[model samples]
Target: MKPFHHLYGPVPSRRLGRSLGIDLVPHKICTYDCIYCQIGKTTQKTLVRKEYVPVMEVIEEVERFLKEETSSIDYFSLSGSGEPTLHSKIRSVIEGIKEITSIPIAVITNGSLLYLEEVRQDLLYADVVLPSLDAVSSDAFLKINRPDEGLSAERMVEGLVQFRKIYKGQIWLEILFCRGINDHQDELIRMKEAINRIKPDQIHINTVVRPPSERWAVPLSQKEIEKIKNIFGDKASIISEFDRPPFSLTEGNIKEEILKILRRRPLSLNDLSEGMGIPTEELERHIQPLILKGSIEVRSFGESVFYEVVKEIQISRP
Candidate 1:
């Protein structure tokens, strides 16, 4: 077995179940340098979007994997490293994958670029768009998200509100609450107002769970998460931490393989590391090729960066 390269997990997700992620940007290249980010800081921050990786190569890898057997993947997610929308070729990539498979495609974004018509157009094809709105106030927004220049809380909100007018697919808006930061009564009220305007299909309330970039970042108690959820009504729910034991893999497949390990539930990086005894650095290297090819992606809950495969990429004989 070549080990599944260019893909990572059928990893468990808080929002999307059994998602396969597709990373289209370089590591940590995002518009925001969030304090609680799990993947660290934005080493290269910009609004520029271009083809960071070849779409054809990614499609080829996905083609090979789907040929073997259908795993438990539920989504072909556009996420990882930094922001997915920053990749200029995202539209082409999304369209290309759709030509091959009918798997529901999703894009996990920070909602920074939604103000741009181009950005909204690029995301229209996605079956679901999971965007983050951590704070409604600029002071708290800067304090928590640490976004790039010119990205204001008011401006970001406006973009989100506008995007909804045209987008027909599901919009699962996420709001990550950092204790003592954006998790106050006043802030939540403002967030509620914003949520009402956008009227997303789901309001995913999240907190810092893993090791965060800032030491002060803390996960909210179950009680606190519930309180916020109440404000949002039935569509709101606290994000549950997904945990699964890792599976042991053969030594030879350690480096090149991108195994979509069979699991009934979600798995974490610790599970994969401990279960396979693969060094963290080695595991990253194995997944790097996939990320570069736009076949895999990375996401963080706090300090932990989890990998998933992109399900949208499928190959067919002409």
Candidate 2:
């Protein structure tokens, strides 16, 4: 069976294995128009929180998925499309999931609203909160994230620090570095300072691997990534380029499975082939229908062609 509208995955995740992703906000509705954003630019860059999706609807889907499916879902990941915390009643969704199952909850956010006490309080029940911090300086923050006008790097860090103190779960702080932009010696030093304040349970370093919004958001070299690891010390780890195990597909529906995986983020044809263990020739049969049906679209990044679920009705292939 196809996944419910708001839910996707039980697809492979490097951080959370076989995660069932819940998309709260609409596509690209976020507080930051990050330069390196994989899903492209934020169409609605707002700090004003609202009920982007009905909390009860989200809860209903969660309940239904758990009751019907018997997939080995590792985490009930409350993340999809844009900012999840922006959903006004996200607390209810989190609490609702908790009421229904034993699966851990993860909220992947850009970490913009963590400065707000209400936001932090709402996320208190999560098993893990993966918040991102790509810049420490105002210039770098603006250049990299292009956050909502009032949202500054200092405020974001302050919120994260406060959350760390009160949060009872794991905080895997992610830092996305854009080469020559936020990966300089000075930037790393300032980043280390902010990281110390947050005191996250774990630190993750990530560079642009997938197709980013701007063509200029280049990937860093292995030597540079290793160097940053040294700078952040032991708690900091790089999100590996290597694929993780258990890309377990659903029982009988490959089409449903492909769309489910693509909805999370963009994946190259080879990425899909390698990760799903479907040969390129066989996978193309699946890909052809998805492309023809206007359910998914493709774009070229570096030397790879990446497929993503269509954001709008009109589809274009590159």
Candidate 3:
């Protein structure tokens, strides 16, 4: 198979299982520069929606990958290093992919653009829309998300409420709590009120599990999150590790495959093991050499250790 610029992984996901990710926008162009973003700070933070990447090119890549790959994908996810809904022609991309395959479509977004009716309409065809709402109070929103000048916590909450009205697909609302930022009692009260109005099918509670852009952006403990989960009630649950059985991968070129996935986002050893279906011992053999040659480095976040590509190094494909 030739290299694909727009598509990556049938990577294991905690929520979406064997998701083949499709990148609609380039890296770091987003509406918010989140403190806890694992992908680093956003470079172009704006609310302007345009064709960031060629729509046809993305569709063609999805078609090609579907034709060549035999793995059973659970969802074709529109998510990558940046906010996907920022791409204006996302509707066309969704429509184009649907014409090619029966695999369900999922869009993982920040929910910042959902205030725009056109953006909601574009995502209407998706089987599941996973949108994040980290804070409901403007103070907490500003402190945590550092959104564009045009956006507000009020408007963002309203957007999710409106989207739930028109969108019949599943809405898995994710809320990532940052210690001392959005985890206050007042913020939680406001958040629960907003969640009540939005009425998502599932409320996924998350925290800073990866190395964040700001070192001060810390995670709440599991005990703290469990308490919040109880407040959110029956529909809410903690975002746990992917527990499904691993999928099979074609043997050989394990090193190249590891680099490809790590270039997108950092992954723990278990994440690599589950996603690639490669045993830990075999993967360690491939990973040690890459670390020795300075292609990737390990960073610990919370209790888990993650492997991320060293940005300055240019790793030639093996």
Q: What stretches of model 2 exceed 4 Å from their correct place?
A: 241-252, 273-281, 288-297, 310-318
Query: Candidate 3: lDDT over CA atoms?
Result: 0.90
TM-score for candidate 2, please give it: 0.90
Per-residue CA lDDT of candidate 3, range 1-318, in tens? 677998888777889977899988898999999999988999999888899999989988988887887768889999998999999999999999999999999999999999999998999999999999999999999999999999999999999999999999999999999999999999999999999999999999999988899999999999999999999999999997886676666555577778888888899998998888888888898899899988889999878899998854444544
Q: Write the per-residue lDDT of candidate 1 for residues 1-318, one digit (tens) a residue.
A: 343333555555667766676778777889899888866667987878788777776677667657764444678888876888998878988898888889899999999999999999999999999999999999999999998887899989999999999999999999998888998889989999999899899888888765567778888887988888888899988876544444455555553334444211123555455434456677777667656777666666444565655443332212
lDDT of 2 by residue, 31-143 (tens): 99999998788899999899989988889888888887755677888878899999999998999889988889999998999999999999999999999999989999999
lDDT of 3 at 97: 90
Model 3 TM-score, 2 decimals: 0.97
Task: Give the TM-score ranking, best first.
Answer: 3, 2, 1
Off by over 4 Å in 1: 1-6, 241-318
Model 3 clashing-pair count: 0
Give the candidates in order of lDDT, highest first: 3, 2, 1
Which candidate should be chosen as best, given TM-score against the real structure? 3
